[model samples]
Target: MQRQLIQPYLLVLGIALTLSSCFNEPNYPDTPSADFKGIFKYTIAAGTGVGAAKRDSVVLTIGFKDGDGNLGNDIPVPKADSARYAQNGGWGNYQIRTFRLINKQYVELVQDVNKVLFFPDLTKGKPKGAIEGTIDFRQIFTYGSSFKMYPTKFQIKIRDRSLNESNVVETDTISVPFPN
Candidate 1:
């Protein structure tokens, strides 16, 4: 009876140790990195009469990896630090740039507002280690009635809490629907 109990306990212990050893943390570089995963386009209809308009929305997905696992900001920016955050392009950790193809060339579309987005802390409740995941960012564009389909692309990058910027990733040319 004693031998039987000891054998079962030993087997369980051996199994647990084997499983734990298989879950080794990834050893990625401290600097963040990103890659273009995919792009999806959709149309959003709004209004009825003269105010009617069709807006093109694009969701861009990118894969990111960070070694230190410090990829986001969970705390809200205090009022005193608002100016500092704004000076650095808002309080977003991800920066996106839009480009429209014109005359067989890509020209960056400069907007009065910066296209920055904030992501919540991604390492919550997890051990300090490298993290890899995909993030989807959506953008909407509206054009005049005379406009039609337009070819556009985007470049994106991410920044960690340590202010380390990831490698820039660019999406392939995508056709965007415009008002006709």
Candidate 2:
């Protein structure tokens, strides 16, 4: 009876020790940082006026790290209250800039309408700690009939709740096709 009890206690202790050793807290900078992981392009049908238009869509995967884990917005600000948050970089915590290769130079492509994106609170209902993860951002482009294909890339960065901007990382150049 004594040997059986001792054996069980030892087994439990060994498991606890193993689990503790396997999980080590991550240490990272308080400022959020991001890296371009990959880029994927695909053709999707858009609109149904006469026939569906084939549009090119690209998904950019970015890896990010934040020490304090305050890398996203907890709640969306209502449209009426958006003015108040404008000073704090608006409601979006994730910022993106699109660039297209033109004449061997990369020029920033400004959209007719601003597209704002925000990431959800990463530490929702959990204790704050260092966190790292990847996010995929998708964008669809309707090219003009004048261009058949173009080389494009994007610059990505992330902002923490504290308004600290991360280092900007650029994706590899990809040839985007425009379907007629």
User: Please, what is the TM-score per model?
Assistant: 0.85, 0.82
Candidate 2: residue pairs that collide: none
Alpha-carbon local distance difference test for all models: 0.81, 0.78
Q: What is the lDDT of candidate 1?
A: 0.81
Compose the digit string of candidate 1's lDDT tens values, residues 44-69: 87767774677778899999999999
- Deviation in angstroms for 179 in model 2? 11
> Taking the tens digit of each residue's C-alpha lDDT, what string does model 2 give over 1-180?
999989999999999999999998889999988988999988786666754556788899999989999877756745643453467765357667877777999998865333566767778888899999998988877655545677888887788767788998899988876434
Q: How many clashes in each structure? A: 0, 0
Instruction: Name the best candidate (by TM-score).
Output: 1
